[model samples]
Target: MPPLSRPPRETRALFRNAGAALPTRHAALLERCVERRLRGPAQVLSGHHNTNHVLRLGLLPAVLVGAVPFARLKYRVPRETVEVVPRIWPREWDVLRVVCRFLPEVPRCLAVLGDNHSLHVYRGGTVLSDRGPHGRIGEGLMRQFAAFFARTAGIPAGELPPLPEDWPADGDSDGFLRRLVRFTEERVHRPHRPRFGTLFDAVGIPEDAMARFLRGLHPLTPRPFALLHTDVHRANVVVRRNRIAVIDWELALFGDPLHDLATHLVRMGYDKEEQARMTALWAEAMTRAGRAELTAALHDDLGAYLAFEYAQSVYPDVLRAALALPPHATADDFHAAAHRIGHALSRAREPLRLVDVPPEPHLIDALRHWHDAQNNPATPR
Candidate 1:
């Protein structure tokens, strides 16, 4: 069967609702700007947040149009003035602009719309996960990511602008752990009145023991601050030509770098063996770059951070499954995802315990010894 084409009216409406609200002259100007920047014709490819539309133009790919809402009621805003105006909403454009200036790998900026609106020529690379079946490419990409951040660390804190005032700093290890404890108490340890039925109950995690397990954990020490890609999950990374290209700077911040490393590990579904291999590679890269101290801290903090990361995913999954109601496919899908995450966590728990030793002198070597001992009866600790 032939595929259906998107209706022009529907496409126009989508663009309008997404806040382009452009005048004929302004629309012409935008087209000219796009033409000057891109080699071919531009077409709206997708829409999100009801405002941004992804427009594809030949080799340039889709440029994102970010729009800001105006409060004025009667008069239609003129578009001519809009093209030159600064973006009014979340100021990620400001940071993106700064990053692009500093890093050649980032997408180049085409133009700025009114406050809260702007245009960026898209990067024509596949998001890391969209790369072919995950294997060495993923591993190589991760090592590249570690190297990228290590380079960013050399930028003086005073030189880089502080993270936008709106972005949360909770991705920091200390804040993340503290938030996990609270989420555990409120969602898992309390009465079973969760937004979704508790995963703890489904997984047979006794409510009474949940609090004790969480309370027994200590906060990871905050490491030296550097520019952080706070959400370094699989989806946020792009792999092109076997090189890692990081994206989604929306949650970027200045904080402990280990949080980013931990987030990457958590998202990649790295089992114990894979985690150990990746950590060893990362350590080697950091050591070669003269950042061994930071790498050591990250290796030490991985287990504590993983536990907190797992807890964060649990309640949200449970809540979503409960709210959907009925034995429908969607509900089943949610339940299945929750179940998978629960099981993954259970499997991860043993390795996490082996790796969770506090970071003192010789702590990591000791944990490695302990893990080895558990694996082999003849291996003396």
Candidate 2:
């Protein structure tokens, strides 16, 4: 399939939808923007996997800013890629439909444009990454985070989009994590193996790295599943009126709550003290929500999920760092990539059972060779 940035050759719409959910004026503006190529007030945010334009509009009385601090809308333009990593991609509009039915604090689906280019009401506030507490988000925000987790988990499965046929049975935590490991191996590593095998060997990432990680993994206690914003990093959070609005539902999932918590704990860039505090907060909130069973093995199982996260992330981190290099990469570029990949490898070492970490010179040489081969397929090293 062609990437989201490119218009398809054939004209079968992917995410076609009537703009019934949006306000009439908002719908008309979006229609003009997409159909008539009329650009509007917006801020284009460039990201590795997507380029999003956040529309800035006047906060008229009955506009999109009644409750929100300001009026804004954003359109998604997925970054071009060679499909290196697997994407869970929970149709953003569909996911928003479910969330909006429950949480008004969440964003809503405004419309789907050409090729289903996504347009949604943007939350107005500072993203947590931009202007917020770095390590610990204080007791108040911590409580809000906990409540958000519980509330999201409380969303019934029946309201969610249909799962894939092969999705793990509900609450099959072990199966879910194992499936994730297998996906990284089968979808990511294996397909690119021929191209990156030598590169992997040089970096000490054995072919069976994921397999080994899986084999050593112990089965997890079953936990009730819930909707998980799997990519709840600092950037995905928006703070307004002392409340946090989480955006970007593309990587959302329905799975064990602990996995969701673990992913958040890791990606929020929280220190050890904050992580523990957040874990406690989550436990309390789940109990208060009367879903104590979900965290029955919290202390024991949370680490496993954390390990899986670290283990799975290594592949994409290394690959993206490598792919980000310029065609005529300088020593500085190579040095930066080595640092990125090396950090990934270091994080994955225990989880992936990696030994003999590649020294700097060796890693530099490996990257040079890999880049050369990628640029000049006919030229033998």
Candidate 3:
């Protein structure tokens, strides 16, 4: 390997290859992380899919660097995605390389330890979730977000990675949205039904919920496609030096840019007024980027995407909420879990065409019953 830099293609190949070995220091750190022996200047963070540990790599053996460098190692696990976004291109590492080549605010992906693990330059900052910034953000920050959205939308397909044969042709907004809806139904729900099916039924989600939702979507207007950071919620955003940087490109995809906007608008927990403000900002930015066609369906198509987000999210939200119930959960725990599941189901009701959501008491009873069954699978009903 070149000491300084390698071509992007070679680098991408190296990162994608699961057989490749991590550097000695990185390898040691990964081993410690796997063994849960990580000590000194280390922090462990977990999401549904990956257990991430941050390590201070210090310095190169021969180099005279003054600073203690840091990198985050991600260990893969059986993660779930509620995005329902199509991943036609490569995942996070490549997305970062391509995106950061132009937009530097995005966290740089250093390397992939192996198939399921990755190393990223650990940018120092507090995650937005930790900050819990409520209400509208200032104009400057909003501009930065708008620019990030536009820049990502303008990325050329030629520069990234090869898309699958099933990917819709450019400007096929209809096809793109259809693929997403299909993914939520066929890819997400169908596969996990055997496991979460009962939980879903108890929550009043019918097997044909997505089918009914899809039928109500309006005809999509043609819009140019682009790369999207589909999971850009507060947790995935970092606030450093008065600027916000996006991380976790694992759910990144190439699709209708509005889908990206919709995801961000929802995930950020923006209020109704703030959502309108953001929509305006995004429209202006897209138009300025000479991608006016991308926003043509803003009035109607955006709602479809938002509905889709709420619709698909219910499956994961219900399953995750139920799974989160502790073995010996208290009444308060069950109440909290029930409230959470009720909210998700309530938000999803319109799109999914649910007849009625169970009351909190009913939800609590159902959850307890589900948890009991999970613990005592051998005992017949």
CA displacement after TM-score superposition, residue 35 of candidate 3 (Å) = 8.1
Give lDDT tens digits, candidate 1, residues 1-381. Answer: 322222244443444222344556655566565455445333333211113344433221122232221111110112221111112224555555556555667654444455445555455557766653345445655577667767665555665555446433633557645544564566454544441233343343344444545665765766555666656666666566776666656456566666566666776767667777777776677678777666655656777666655645444443433333333334344445445545544544442332332222232233234334444659754
Enumerate clash totals for all models, in the order shown.
11, 0, 0
Summing lDDT over every window of 10 consecutive residues in candidate 2, give the lowest-scoring window. Answer: 60-69
TM-score of each: 0.58, 0.84, 0.85
TM-score, cand. 1? 0.58
Query: Candidate 1: lDDT of 32?
Result: 67
lDDT (Cα, tens digit) per residue for candidate 2, span 323-367: 889999999999999987887788788888886578888888889
lDDT (CA) per prediction: 0.49, 0.75, 0.73
TM-score, model 2 to reference: 0.84
Which portions of model 3 show Cα errors greater than 4 Å? 1-41, 61-86, 378-381
Put down candidate 3 lDDT per residue, 284-318, tens digits, no spaces.
99899888888986988898988988888887788
Model number with the top TM-score: 3
User: Candidate 3: TM-score?
Assistant: 0.85
